[model samples]
Target: MVAILGCCDSTNPVRRDGGLPGSVPAPSPGALRAEDQLPRQRRSLTSEDRSAIAVGVTCGCSYAQIGAMIGRDKSVVCREVTRNRGPDGSYWAPVAHRAAHERRRRPKPVKLAANPGLCRRIEVAMDEGWSPGLIAAMLRHEHPGTSAAARMGRVSHETIYQALYVQTRGNLRADLHRQLSLKRSARKSRGSTGRGGSHTYDHALTISQRPAQVADRAVPGHWEGDLILGRGNRSAIGTLVERSTRFVILLHLPGRRHDAPSVAQAMITEMSKLPAHLRRSITWDRGSELADYVDIQLNLQAPVYFCDPHSPWQRGSNENTNRLLRFWFEKGTDLSTHTPDDLARIAATLNARPRPTLDLKTPTQALHELLANPPAA
Candidate 1:
């Protein structure tokens, strides 16, 4: 039987009479040169190397360093340690060394190299309705040692997502795919509404025509607004935010009936609360609620700029504000349960949370600072 180099032989070959002997072939000159050109492998670990690896492992060195010392890949080292050492806890050198030696003799392919257990745990958590981000954070917190350091035992939330979407990984557990909020598929972008499309009201200004200062968000008076719908589209809350300060304001829409009159009234009432200096312009999408936008502009004395239809990014501040609002006013709930006062309290809470974008300052502090020393005319 002739055995091919670097190739698998699955069938047993029967002896044939008068056949050439299946002798191993000598290396060709090219192969010899290739082998000679390769870098020399270190035969034994130096004291310094061992010390460094020991220190690293003790001080939470990643599996990568351990593998480098042993002349193996990081995932191989991780699997050896995870499979041999305390599967329940942290890695110890003696146990890890023994595991590595045993694994070298009989290697096993990993289904999910980065934390098979952790991945399973994450799947369980997702089944229980936890988000991927939340699961990642919890793993880092709960299993600090193994979950935080490893090529085979630790993975980011993004990795979890990629594994689910990318087909090459071989779906080990298809059930895990169900945990994703959005199914894996190309998303259809919304069509752009023209700059001159129908407006919430006659003679309304388009976002493109808004002042340069508003676009730059250097001025504190520029505001963006939107609505979040509740279950059955019968309940909703109006959300507005100051672009510069991220200051949030929420309005309780008693019923989901966001008609022109009701929406315009809400805008007027909210804008009326701010001083004239803080009411420069308002940006909104082409929702029917803003049909009476002319009334809002006239009553509030602030220009109303309409975003192109289906373009949520046009009112970025309001879009971001709505995301934060979701933390409190979740989707598919009866938003009408909250009163104007309740909505005000929710807005106040959000304004008090520190924002990294705002130099870790709470929106309240940022807004107060802006109001304290108003930008020069």
Candidate 2:
């Protein structure tokens, strides 16, 4: 034998048999070799990577050992496990991977995160119970000129809202959401006769009295209205739909009642948000729930019109939207269970949705355009 032991198999200097040694065993025949497939550039773990981790964990592999197997730094594996565990704190592969996907999707830096002043303004307004839309308008109103407005951090309500719902962006504190009137983890649609309520109106301006311009939908301010009732008509929500822009507003009411006074107050607080030009008129059904119509007309300075008795069609836009709202406030559920902040979130969702009437523009976009170039009152 001519000194047969020359660097453990001579030709191959880095063989597992003698060199640095194998970190991981060769993949079992046909096993998914996804460990090396994770995107190195983005620093995000892929679903396939998660599946491999599950296999490694099942096989009693330690984190450092697993990191070696996957060609990743041990610290990276450590962070992934700590950050993306499930609600139960168990590192189930599927749940951890799904959460990673949600966290990795932060497409833009949140407006509140970018501007400290804007963040402060939002926090103050939220504490005062102002909706995100109201905060946005206030920012614009205070900084009127276009260039000055941009410089002053005049962001849209949609942007403020984006921070709240998307997991990847946490510019707004999670506790601040509790300060919002309705506090739902997710939004719900609202409307009901079967889904929400109905009341009869007396001595009210009839929809027939509404102006021709209002009927044509050419102008931006005209709105249609209705209510979604809760179980046995005990609880309710006030819903308003803009005829031209197809925008929606939801009113949070007294938990047990959508009474005339309560409904009127809710509408007053919500509608007071619009500029004078955008407060032209509101057409609703003759449901007695709006017995405070005269008060709404006088105080809002926006006239109110009633639909003919038993005819939901007179408030067609409102009627259609109410049905769509049924997806959230189902007929037999307790409407009172939802908070005002919940209604605000739901309205945001409704406004952000694309509408066929507005050439596929979202109600939020159509409203934005209208706000930019409103028609003469």
Residue-pair clashes per prediction, in order, are: 3, 17
Per residue, candidate 2 scores C-alpha lDDT tens digits across 83-172 of: 766556567778888777776685645656767767777888899889888988887887776454565568888777777776656367
Segments of candidate 2 deviating more than 4 angstroms: 1-202, 375-377
Candidate 2 global lDDT:
0.73
RMSD to the hidden true structure, all candidates: 14.8, 18.1
C-alpha-based local distance difference test score of model 1: 0.66
Worst 10 residues of 2 by lDDT: 1-10
Worst 10 residues of 1 by lDDT: 11-20
What TM-score should be assigned to candidate 2? 0.47
Pairs of colliding residues, candidate 1: 114-152, 115-152, 115-153
Over 8-46, each residue of candidate 1 has an lDDT whose tens digit, in order, gives 123322112211136354233245347454453644333
